[model samples]
Target: MKALTTYIISQTKLPEVSVKNTIELLNEDCTIPFISRYRKERTGNLDEVQIGDIVKFKEQFEALEKRKIAILKALEEQGVLTPELKQKIEATLDLTTLEDLYLPYKKSRKTKAETARQHGLEPLAKIIMSQNANDVESIAFKYVKGEIASVEDALEGARHIISEWINERTDIRNNIRQQLERFAMISTKVVKTKADDENAQKFRDYFDWEESLSRIPSHRLLAILRAESEGFIKTKIQIDDDKALDKIESRIIRSNNECSEQIQIAIQDAYKRLLLPSLSNEALQIAKTKADESAISVFAKNLKQLLLGSPLGEKRILAIDPGFRSGCKLVCLDAQGGLLYNETIYPHPPQNDSMGAIKKISSLTEAYKIEAIAIGNGTASRETEAIIRKIHFKNEIQVFVVSEAGASIYSASKIARDEFPNYDVTVRGSVSIGRRLQDPLAELVKIDAKSIGVGQYQHDVDQTKLKKELDVVVESCVNAVGVNINTASASLLSYVSGIGPKLAENMVSYRDENGAFTSRNDIKKVPRLGGKAFEQGAAFLRIKEAKNPLDDSAVHPERYDLVKQMAKDLGKSVQDLIGNAETLKKIDLKKYCTESVGLPTLQDIIKELEKPGLDIREQAKVFTFNQNIKKINDLHEGQLLPGIVNNITNFGCFVDVGIKESGLIHVSNLSDGFVKDVNEHVSLHQQIIVKVLEVDVPRKRIQLKLHT
Candidate 1:
């Protein structure tokens, strides 16, 4: 345990006490958001990222220890556990080194070496290995028995045993691994059968490509590997064969005699049959794991930005899922996102009933008091927008084109089915588009993160790892903005600090049976919700119109008495202290600091009082695309257009320029100077102007340069 603590501290470069405290908190089953937000004093105010690192490293070290125990037990059962071997295994932290040490003792199927030993050639093999045998042929002749027909046969058997011995040597394996890591090249070739397939055209760039394994970017690696998985290309890791052989020969050969000649044969066999294949696979696996981590990190970052994008607040929205031949599915949602009405309008092709659609829209807008219109950016979306614009509404209504990337997926999900048992998929989808404009975080939590489509190669990365990383991001975002206790659905509440799916269901069920929660303390009455759950989750759950205004803010329930005392000290009520910026500015944070609540927590409390239950997210604004250029063919070179950054990767960002196909803004064109990271230049959903550099009509590719 001490060694594990030391290792985590060294890897994270964090204070030892803080690491230890975080480990203790995690061991006590506290979630990362809980520890980061509430347990600031114990963790030295380490944020969620730092705490997440601690958790990851601790899990890795624990897994390594488990492997060590299994290896030790195996060696003991095999009756080969010497004190020296056991000590080496116990003291080493590197998994590769430990595996190398245990290779000789590991059980395997019968091999050439075992066959030679079974035929009574062990003595002859040892004599040759000593490198002191003169007249090795005569020495080998003496060991001729069953399976050993002549002097040549005996010598061949001896060589085979020596080859296996060299392969198992710890020094030899380690040296070969290092060489492969430093000089290996990854190369890919298109499979002949798949060369002409249309599906394989996307990987043409990698069909005849070679790059240094250590220097290839994460995206390229994932792309090539994905192509290989789909049978479009074959990949191989290559190193200089001569250099590798020379290094191994130098380590094994110590003399220049007949015995040395035999050893050289063994070395060649070892290099070809054992070391190269094993280490090349190891190197590729290492590279693949690294690529997976990088891709998952990128996905998590993009997902965080997209989930926390600006919200339209609680507005009465009229959402439309537009289609050409099928007309448009429209639904009206109240301020809290409850579906008040739904119907279809044929403002587009086939049934172009423009007058009827306009009358229906205007009457519905006035009947439900619609404040905004959210139109899905799909087929006939532009025509639908034009129809809505043509209508003269009684009042000003803002119209927004919302991305409908995963609305269909959400509508077909079981959660959606349960939410709207009587509504069809179209109605549910329109409702999703409306609610997304209202609050992206709340609505997005109900769908799978992968369905949101902000990721790169999301389906190809490690699924378990990607899911874990994305779940953490969602949790962080949810807790960052906080959830309304009375209005939050089971899906949104499930992401709060310590509450999970079961508890979330329980809370909703409890709410349905009783009325709305009037205070944060009332949440404890839910079945199976204990003291610890309340302590971890109470701060992130907001209750509007509560008796104590602190219940609606981020201030934890544990600090309520302290806040009351502060208000009493100021000779004012709690309500008077809250939202009174002048009074809050005069309070000395140092005077309120305690052993558990430091200056950081005190400052946070003061900020919370200044604006209780404040949202950090910006309000959503209306964006206009180039009305004249609605399709790809309409674009020309050097034409400046308005676009929104839809996705970001290591290479560049893809911007939606109000067309079916998005344009690529390469990293080189992101800025006037060197741009190391594309994210530093633009974020997901950021509106910017770009100039069309070139357009490949045949390939449907658009090259764009960002304008400052």
Candidate 2:
């Protein structure tokens, strides 16, 4: 374990104890699910994110070790093995770094070195490099009688040979590569032909931008690179090779001699012809790789926040997909997300019926005892909110504007069709818009996450890699917040660790064959859901009205016996001891210690007993706004306007006010006082209330004040 820890830390740039602690816990034969959930004490309470990092680090370390062994064996076979070389190879972390060390020994392309060796010019080139020769061109004449005809040809041939010798020097190439990477500037220019392309327009702003290779933001770099690849722009890294070569040559050759100029020329030519392209390629690739990694990390962060966005809990909600020219689509769903009502209201249309629409909404709110009204933050949303707010309902209800980011995509999806076959697309969309607010997990599974628009550059990223990463994230989130076994749809159930589509369907089939799961143990009867599967997934599958309360909580069944043992030690039945607060208080759970169970596990158990199937919801919840106030002229100084944060740049944030336009809240207007980064003040999806400070109706833009 210590050896593995050293290896992982050295190879992965991870801390030593992180790997050591992780491997030690894994050696105890705890499952990923178990270690992540119950063995928090052993793993230092490392969350799923940290555990996943450890897993990746371990895999990469092992793979690198295998590669190192292969490289060492191959080098030993070539009979160039040295203790120093072996140590350097073993110590190297990056594959590129190791490859840099081994480039001299690696197989080559057609080069002047092989040609010179064939023509017998290597000895002459060597003589010239040694600077022992009075004149290199004169010395080369001795070997140039038959093949090298003229002094010019012989010098040219010998120069090629000497240049190849210079190129083969790994130290020189490595030094030059390092220098170029540090000083190069990444410059992108928009291609002139495609300036009018719709996608090209977004990148037009970046076409003429320049940034140092080291400092460009990952998002902007990727966006620019993607635009260039799509033929909307052209990009290149500009480096002054003359300046770079001068520094390198001066550092390498300190002595002033007649042969120094020749050597310097050879070095410069070798760099320009042989080493620069490969090194620039490497540097660019590294830059791109770092950018890609940063973007993915940001994407993962945003996605986790978006996916775990507060679930409103199970509630009957009336959804309104608002439209102006067309009528508003109204959908009402039961607490379990089953659609109960579908109707349309022409509040503002050819057959405008504002009062009639109000009456219909009022009637449904009263008849269904609607708990909330979910209004889509699209067209006519604020008008619908206004109308719904005016209606007097016998039942108390709250109105929320739900983000309809992927609601349209879900409505047009095959799953949506299967769920709502008789309804029109608009009605299905309205229901999805509502259900997303009621339970984000259950409804979100129906739509592709990339379409949800929470991530930047999700579409342009490596699709397979993105899907694998996002699927893991979704699964982690779904299981972390345990699912309701009986009510969860197959789409939702498939996200469970061990339950794929077929198994999810089988579980549902088994339930249909028998009845609702009365106990967590009954899940074993479901075909393909064997003991190992149960061990991984059972803890996250909650059974409402189950025989054991612990089963509904995140407590694994293996620990059930331990809980019972605790109850026995307390001279009370397990059921009585679980809810018996007085007895539980008296019992020191640290006394029930095992190799796996500790303070964290015992405390989790006590908390679970308090609320067996607690669904933690967000507090002080806010909703999305559909209306936009585009122009500053259209708003009074004190008017409060609902706005969507469109773009967050260095200066300020741009918000889309519903007038088919947008407004900017300058950095000064962002607060009562000073602000640094716009991202610190607002995020991409945040819906904020802004006061209109200044209006430019001619430009169709508004200046907003966020302070008040």
Candidate 2 residue lDDT tens string, 47-163: 777777777666666777788898888889999879999999988866767776777677668776666677776676666667656765677668866666766665566668777
Q: What is the lDDT of residue 96 in candidate 2?
A: 69
Q: What TM-score would every model get versus the actual structure? A: 0.97, 0.85
Clashing pairs in 2: 628-657, 628-658, 629-658, 632-695, 633-695
- Per-residue CA lDDT of model 1 for 378-469, tens digit only, reads 88887788788889999999999998988999999999999999999999999999999999999999999988999789898889999999
**Where does candidate 1 stray beyond 4 Å?**
150-153
- How close to the true structure is residue 532 of candidate 1, measured as C-alpha lDDT? 84
Q: Which predicted model would earn the best lDDT? A: 1
> Clashes per prediction?
0, 5
The per-model lDDT (C-alpha) reads: 0.92, 0.75
